[model samples]
Target chain A: MSLKNTEAVVLSQLRLGEADRIITFLSPQLGKFKGVVKGGRSLRCKMLASTMPLTQVAVWFVEKRTSGLHLISQCDIINPFRTLKENLHKLVSGLYLTELVEVATWEVEPDEGLFELLLWGLGSLAAGERLQAVLRIFEIRLAVLLGYEPQLSFCLGCEKELAGRESYYFSFAKGGVICAKCRAGARGCKISLGSVNFLRQALRFQQEKLGRLTLTAASSKELQQILPAYLSYHLERKINSLRFLNLLNVRC
Target chain B: MLYTESLAKLVAELKRMPGIGNKSAERLALYILGLPKDEAGKLAQAILQLKERIFYCSRCGNITEVDPCTICQSPARDAGILCVVEWPNDLLAIEKTRGFRGHYHVLMGAISPKTNIGPEALRIKELQARVSSQQVREIILATSPTLEGEATAMYLYEVLKPLGRITHGGRIGVCR
Candidate 1:
């Protein structure tokens, strides 16, 4: 077993044995991994605070390659993002973001870009950015980072440039838009050109400039339907946290 | 050497328990096999009795053999002060301290977005019902200190704020 130290964000934790816990985390160097923390459930354990989900932590662990479960020796919280956890809506959004990362990633395969994007998402929520804007940006950027970037530039059916299309059919199965002429037999949903333009800009914006891009009501509604379906199509699984977020929105 | 069918079945069944590994399951099976016949019979009967008689108290969601539970039915306990916890074991832990004389409400679980469980999936509605119908004066948010637990506590505070005064972590007399 080799010793490794990396900055990771806690994804989720499960109770192990009587007082131990199995913590899953996402790291820049290690895509996703699970580590066993001894006595994590104890009220006075130092690991208690560091192991909480969505907390950015610096962890030193022994990688047990044979068993596939690392042993976390020491972990220190880098940033607790306390504000995100203090608000219910923000907390749910944070959990949903982490859960998506955890589900989309594979173990031990490093993806620094995705890791940075996750930190940005969590930081934005903690800083009190608009919730809808944060969710849409995170989803679009996540799709791009994972190589499932939506084909927003052209119509898939006739290979025509989609610069001035009034409306288009976004095919979840094809992962792009189909023009009106191509819509006869296409299995897709109609989306407005305004939503398309906003998404295209979102995809090209730098991380720092992403916040400056705001979503119109129509675009927000369109994206709220499109990106998730696109990601779910590519990832081949229903993201459970999205359902939880929907419930919270309904309550509001 | 392979164990007989009966021994293997016992080992398999024991392994299904939490924290029980193959070694522990085998050891426990052997210990049970070596017990006196009458003792073994009594143990089996006790397990059957537990599953048959034990159930959650309708009022507070705590496990009990009775409907309202002894704590709920007791006149000595304060109905106005309610201690809300994440699970029944938490209720027992606080009860063991014998410091608080208030009744309890077990939420059964916390709000965990990863698991897709929201406030509606918890005991929050029943809690609201209890608070509106009763003369509750103070609610002690004794949920755990974990992320999910804290979120659940915050959600509860928002929902129960207009109903009465809500204090966190059971720290009474420390005004918020």
Candidate 2:
């Protein structure tokens, strides 16, 4: 049961004892796993290419019987994600995707469909799609995958059949939108009608079709405010990377 | 468990050091005991002295004993060209190469979101103040090539671009 051979995306790596490195990988079959690469820090290390932030690699490792780091016997880079390294925007997107995968999934839990989502996220990012839009999609999809899909129906207060053609108040506490009549002193941010539709479309959009779907600036801004609030409320903590990305948006 | 109380204390303190395991720490504690009394005392004094004397330069954020680091105080270095680095050690590395003649601004760390480090956490405001105070023509953004480093460079570039009609972007000579 310790032996492993699968395609994995290298998430993060940290230095271990002198010449070794402990690499975190997200594999389709294994979900997330950590293993040791002996002599990985040396100059002539052939497995060097396999451990970059978002690289797709073929890795072979033997898991220990006890709860300890597995021994990585062999690894080869299947896809280097060269574009992710070359373009600064793509690189940040890549790092964001890696961090999302790292936090969303548990180690060796075989997270159902998370590996596929990660692959799609990285592939779309490297292909030069809109950076903010790609992240929005990834964030929404990740939340859905983890079974915390935000309620996108009628207002929590009025419970009326709301038309999706106007702006509505989204409350983190009520878990969804608040009607205009009931929005008196609502403790939440406003979500545009377009963003609500975009979110619905994103939830159902296929991975291959994400590249064709465009995210307008208004929609992006609304999603930027609403999605993070939803995630923080449901996940019970704010993600640091989201804050960093928001800072970039403010400055850029 | 068999060691004397003082020896045990030394080993525990030594074990707190990075890359020092229990065995290496024990060996270091024993080694220190064998050293001359004056030398051992000197080692303890040196560690305490470093903590007391070395401080960050308020303007540039580099480690220094003086108020402003030597690089910030030197007149020979070009004030128009600022070289931003992630850490003090990076400044030392560039200094060792003997190729650059610009003043340095250490960010203390790069933009690492996973670690909860952002522009607000870094010396971004100080860097901005320096940019405004000096007649800088072209900033040499010299953060490392890692993801966080590049992100920090780009973050600075985007923030600095709107302030003036100056050149922007990092990776040496790719100004706009």
Candidate 3:
């Protein structure tokens, strides 16, 4: 067994027994791993709040070789993103971010960039940034970070530059754009050129400069139409949080 | 090591239980095998009766042998004050304290978007109906301090705010 200490964001947690929980985390160094926390479910346990989903913490855990489930020894809360928990929309969005991270990545494959993207996304939401822009930026950037970057520059069908198209069909299977001429009977979501340009900018922006780029309401609507469906298609599973997020969006 | 088919089947069934591993399941199976015939029969009968008889209290969502549950039907408990909890166990925990005399509403689960659970999945609608129909004066959000718990509480607070005065019991556990 090896004791490892790393900073992580809680992705999700499940109850283990009477007073224990299995916490899934995404760490900059450790990637994704599940660790059992003794007394984690106890109401009075000091680690109760620290071990919650979406909270960031520095955790020390023992990596058990036999079971492949680590035993978490200590966790110190970094930023609980307490604000996100207060608002349902923000909370759902934050959970969606974590769920994306949880489902998109594999275990123990550390990617510092992906970890930073998650932290940045959560921080932006908690800081009360524009919800739609934050979400759209996060979705595009995350897709790029995970190497599923959408083909925004050119038409997949005719290999033509897609700079001045009125609109294009985003092909989920091809992970790129299909021009109007090439989209005959092809299954894809219709996206406006403005939305396409915004996504390209989102992909090209520096991580630190992401906040400076705000999405227009029109582009926001268009990207929202395609990004999640694209990601879900590539990920090959229904994103559990999307339905809840959609419900909230419709209500508001 | 190989066990007889019957013993192996029993062990496998027992191992399916939460917190029960191979060793504990085997030990429990052997212990059950060693029990007196009538004692073993009684144990099996009890399990059967539990499944057959016990059900959720329709009014408060607590597990009970009756429809409305004793607490909901109790004359001593104050119906005007409702304590909202994430699960039935939280209600039991509060009952063990015996300090509060209010009725309880068990949500059955909390809102965790990661798990695809939302406010709609919970008993928030029933809670609203109860508040609207009854003369409820105060709602104590006795959810846990965890993210899902807090989220559930906040969502309930938003839904139940215009109806009555809401008391936020941010921490509902044994701790202060």
Docking level of model 2: acceptable
- Model 1, residue B80: C-alpha shift (Å): 0.8
Q: How much native contact recovery, as a fraction, does model 1 achieve?
A: 0.86
Off by over 4 Å in 2: A1-3, A14-20, A38-49, A85-90, A151-161, A164-189, B71-81, B98-102, B135-138, B160-170, B173-176
Please give the distance, in angstroms, between residue B33's alpha carbon in candidate 3 and its true position after superposition: 5.5
TM-score of 2: 0.84
Which lDDT tens digits does candidate 3 get at residues A1-252?
A: 878899999999898877889999999998999999998887777777788888999999998988868999999999989888778889989989988889999999999999999999999999965898889989988888878988888899998987663568899888889898888888998888888878888888887887888788888878887898888988888899898888878877
DockQ for model 1 equals 0.69
For every prediction, compared with the true complex, DockQ reads 0.69, 0.42, 0.59
Query: For each candidate, what is the lDDT?
Result: 0.87, 0.80, 0.86
Cα distance off (Å), candidate 2, residue B30: 1.6
**Residue range A64-150, candidate 1, lDDT tens digits:** 989879999999999999889888889889988988898899888889998899999999999965888888899988998888887
Candidate 3 CAPRI grade? medium
Which whole-number lDDT from 0 to 100 does residue B94 have in model 3?
95
Measured by TM-score, how close is model 3 to the native structure? 0.89
| Candidate 3 - chain A - TM | 0.96
Q: Please, what are the lDDT tens digits per residue for candidate 3 over residues B37-112?
A: 9999999999999999999998999999988899999999889888999899999999999899989999999987
Candidates 1 and 3 compared by DockQ, better number:
1
lDDT of 2 at A147: 85
Query: In model 2 chain A, where is the ten-residue run with the lowest total lDDT?
Result: A243-252
- Which of the two, 2 or 3, has more DockQ? 3
